[model samples]
Target: MKPNPISVVTFDLDDTLWAVRPVLLKAEDIVFDWLEEFAPKLTDRFTAKSFMKWRWDIYANYPELAHQISQLRTITVQLALEESGYSTAEAKTLADQAFEIFIEARHQVLPFETAIPMLETLKQHYRLGVLTNGNADIFRLALGQYFEFSFTAEQLNASKPLPEPFLAAQAHAAVNASEIIHIGDSLEHDVIGALDAGLHAIWFNPDDKEISADVTAKYHVNFYQVQCLSDIPAVIDTINKSRLHSRVTSP
Candidate 1:
């Protein structure tokens, strides 16, 4: 019997496996409380909304740090502290401490009901990995047990909808593009990016968003869509059967 054509499966971390907004909001609140205690002067200077604006300004000024989430965030904290009158050395220390608090709280996510079961089944059949634009580490969460490897935009210095991240994942898996699949929630970053990079992509569109005809025409690649994580294994099986039939029927 022939082997399964699809051997590797990579996933996006944030919204694909679990809701990110609540976790991030909670993390921010925790960080704010910590800052209030440790750096009361900084909290006195800026509210969350204004601090975010400052961070965006920093991002605009240093485009090179755009993909480096951890660095960018640390720098944002350091600058905010300095602006609030801390000395440079003091700000740097506080920034690192603040980031540590934020990151720890960030990992307190509640996974979707189906995320683990879906990963459990998929891992038994294919090499599983992660490719995420966010800094959420799978190893920090329970889902870490399901993945063999992971790549992040911050680590690679490249974000998706650009081909480098996808290409890097394919290389790491030691598989041809056709033999790998990338599953994620974002159409532009995950679906279109993976398809453009010559890999099969499954859009984890739980929101039931419509993929317009113009998107297909613009990308010139077709992709699979699934509303439920549980449907993924069946989609991969369908992809394998279709590839097998194509091989047998092709000239």
Candidate 2:
């Protein structure tokens, strides 16, 4: 069968392009340190580690925050400040400023060595965009120049492994689902989710994690894997060529 030629390449920002955990850990520390100096009562009441746990607690208690990551963060900070004895207005202002500090630090990511070069190559032939559940603003980072658009869970009102965000991306790119390829570090959110939504997927497994055989057998169509960032464009080229060969040989 002739492949639906790929046109739009969508990426999941967080762990796919860079190590998100370290970035988040550092951002958390920055936020807490800022709070320690400006809102000492909050720091006195809770350590940075405890503050992180409280943030998760708020996320767990509020189902509505599943897609509103920024709001969840802000609310967590505001509530902590209020509990630490700040007035409502003061807490709100402090929370907003604290989140700004966190996000700025969050953007200070160290991408893998070949990430930029790979994006540069891919962007020449494909329309690149971002689809993420996290708050990693691509435009805040140097790599944002390559992406044509970015869709967050907060903006789309749905998060992966849900199909809504994938479908929304397909619509936004004005391309058939089969013509789009989503690359991410997640098995469920990136590979299965994209395949389930009728788009292709490339699993960006830098750690070379094992995948259960059953998972692979289930969604074999248009699913691929790559351990190195530089291998992506080549794999994509192969997908198209193999499909073309199949088209020529089919009886």
Candidate 3:
């Protein structure tokens, strides 16, 4: 008559839940079309290379805003427009509209085939949450039903690879690090950062990539990892049973 030891599990949204590349590519295309129609003169001067330069420049100047990708992107567009000969006020207005277009398109993602079917089952066992660096809105996509809370780098002011978000998750659950686990695609951001913050981690390695030299050290010993989304339920069961057994056997 004991409660589950693993009370919470947080997930990364972009590459973990869906393929990010196609969505981003489509979002970029949407933005390009919007710009051509709304600000033809700015589009005439705009190039991908120049857009990247402007974005990186914003990163350089405002390192504190580094984790807030939405703001960074908005400012990038704003600055690029100003440089392309728009008045500052017009630049800001057009930049906001351009970002609105991009963000709407960004949410049109195709979740991995296994993702939704598995979520209801997982939610029965663990209080699930989302922790993402990207700006995808779960509520808009109707994915909020599967999760109890959602955290974003934009809101946290700290992305993955930093301990802040993981620590925040631990605090949100009001539990020790051992009671929470995170799963994501990035070895550096997901596994390493979670472990560094003392939370358990699982690498959702759908691509079947090998762990690079340094990441293989302590992480392999400390956490459960999976190569496919379909494998997650079994992995979580193993972790839950292992934790339960340890607690029962402990003196």
Candidate 4:
């Protein structure tokens, strides 16, 4: 039970740090506008609702590509264009261009008031990183400086709430599970994923909703729950201190 010194801190993007729903809604609107002007054949054939359904169908058919949302979206756009009578070459060019615009708008995010400040503070002590299932480009938003590295489900072909990406992060950081802590908003995705991979977890439940992810009693001690950004450091400190004391007192 020796105190495991923390070396790396990993986080979730999207709702954990910013309001992603608005960002995505605006991003979708921007993409829709771009498509109407630049790829009208595709737009004329399908409204936004059906366009979204086509995107969903892409994932449903080829789930092995689940983590690669960017690619899936690009493929969906290309299919829409081709189905609307664009030639193969034209469809490919339009899809790639449209996807570029979509992603550029996607990273345009507004962080929570304390989110960046807390990251700045943590960067002073730990090697911070991001692990996200979404196609968010932190580097595109000038937030890259805060993270030492990022693990995207897009690159791994595996998403979180599953242990592949989390274990991959553990290997990349070259630290034991005890030496790392993951913070994110989803009870199932961040907390359960981290614990399943043998790391400590801090649930960033900002809404303070009742815990519903089914925590069996034995695993409770490995969890830390936080409602506000400023509270994270203290909770992490408490875990470290508890581990140190356990080491000291063990027979």
Candidate 5:
């Protein structure tokens, strides 16, 4: 039996394509230093620990702001200033200036060595698209040409583990859910969300942690797992083969 041809392959950016945490940490440091220099009042509210905590607090407080990481950082800086007794207008200006410094210094990304080459290879065989929940301007990162379309939580107004964003990617890819495969690093958001949206999913588990029993059940129902980006092409090939076999077996 021949394998099923996978028409569309969608990916989550951030951790899936690159080592996001280190880049983000460095970016945050750059931002913090800028705040100290130009927005000293705002900087007073954020020690490294408090700044990290504030990020989650802000996310919880403004769920709609999840996809706008950059904007959220600005707002966080502004709010931190206000909390520390600055006037709203003062906070806004300081935060905006600090954020500009952060943005200019934040262009460095640590994409895995295999990521771009893998994309180059995969693009030849399948339609590629991005379904990230991040504010990383993928186009600015020079990855835009590899993808036929890209969707974000901001664009769809829905974040993963929700079906809306996944469906949005499907729409952008112009393919049915079953014909597309979604890949990403988060087991909860990427794997479960894509599965729920009726697409096959691949868990990009670079950390080698075992999926919990609870997650295993979810994974077994609709997804496969891969330890590295390098494994993706083989996984796609296997899926295509299985698809072909099933079709041949059908009446």
Candidate 6:
């Protein structure tokens, strides 16, 4: 039988509601251009790809910094300069400059075409919220109105795949976990994390990647699969109808 209708719907910001790669690429270009112009000494050591690699490596090494992307970017720039033979003071200055350039550039966001319309539809029927590991200020990009609440790992000090952030989102939304539906692209982070927190999850698997054997092996299950934002309303209707039937049949 189908489960209860979701009363609250929380979404992952990056790659789920929007196409983040283009915005990130534009941000990187702006940062690199600034570094090349103002901090030419640091430019030689830091390329965008290498910078991203180093940032991810640092996040992996210091799991505590997982939600601190800004800090990770800053440290990555500093480390790149030091590795390329710059002194500590010089690296620090370059890192600060790079971070400023990146942050200002990142504010120029281009939300996906479907994002606003879909949110408008969902907002009418369900409480809407955001669950992310990114900087909280990201809402300043002009997508804040649709959500009644937004929670990030930085605020909770715990990233996804850990249940804290999801639970935190539930608290912030003032909704029970079972009544919340989470939508995200990452199987490990979104699906597993929401499930761990007892929220219904929907895998936004636009890429058509086969379900992993490991996920299947663990017996993890999601409430639905959505290939596009347009599919959401239908899925919600299905869930609601099933819930109505279950209620009617209960002894």
lDDT of each: 0.90, 0.90, 0.84, 0.85, 0.81, 0.79
Better of 1 and 3 by TM-score: 1
The best-first sequence of candidates by lDDT reads 2, 1, 4, 3, 5, 6
Model 3 lDDT per residue over 1-251, tens place: 44347779899999998999999988887888788888888778867556656667667887877887888888878888898899999999999999989989999999999998778789988889888888887878877799988888888888998988888888888888878889999988988888899888889987788877676776788877787787787787888888799779777
Clashing pairs in 1: none
Measured by TM-score, how close is model 2 to the native structure? 0.95
User: Superposing every Cα of model 4 onto the true structure, what RMSD results?
Assistant: 1.7
Candidate 2 lDDT by residue in tens digits, 1-251: 45667889999988899889999899999999999999999999998889888878778888877898899889989999999999999999999999999989989999888899999999999999999999888998889999999998999879998998898889899988988999999999988999999889999998889888888678755588999989999999988887678778878
The pairs that clash in candidate 2 are none
Candidate 3 residues lying further than 4 Å off, grouped into runs, are: 1-4, 48-58
lDDT of 5 by residue, 1-251 (tens): 33346789989998898877888788778877776787676567678668768767767787677667777788887888888788999989888987777766565776888898889989999998888887766777777789888888877777888898888877777767888899999888988898888888999988886878987765675677887798898889888888888888887
Per-residue CA lDDT of model 4 for 146-222, tens digit only, reads 99888899878889988988888888898897789999998788888898988888999888877644574656667
Task: Give the per-residue lDDT digits (tens) of candidate 1, residues 1-251.
Answer: 44349999999989999999999988988988899899999889989778777877778877898799899999988999999999999999999999999999999989989998999999899999999999989998778999999999988899997888888888898888888899999999999999989888999999989777889687635788999999999999998998899778777
Candidate 2 root-mean-square deviation in Å: 1.6
Task: Choose 4 or 6, whichever is better by TM-score.
Answer: 4
TM-score for predicted model 6 compared with the true structure: 0.86
Predicted model with the maximum lDDT: 2
TM-score of 1: 0.95
Q: Which stretches of candidate 6 lie over 4 Å from their true place?
A: 1-4, 46-61, 82-90, 136-138, 217-221
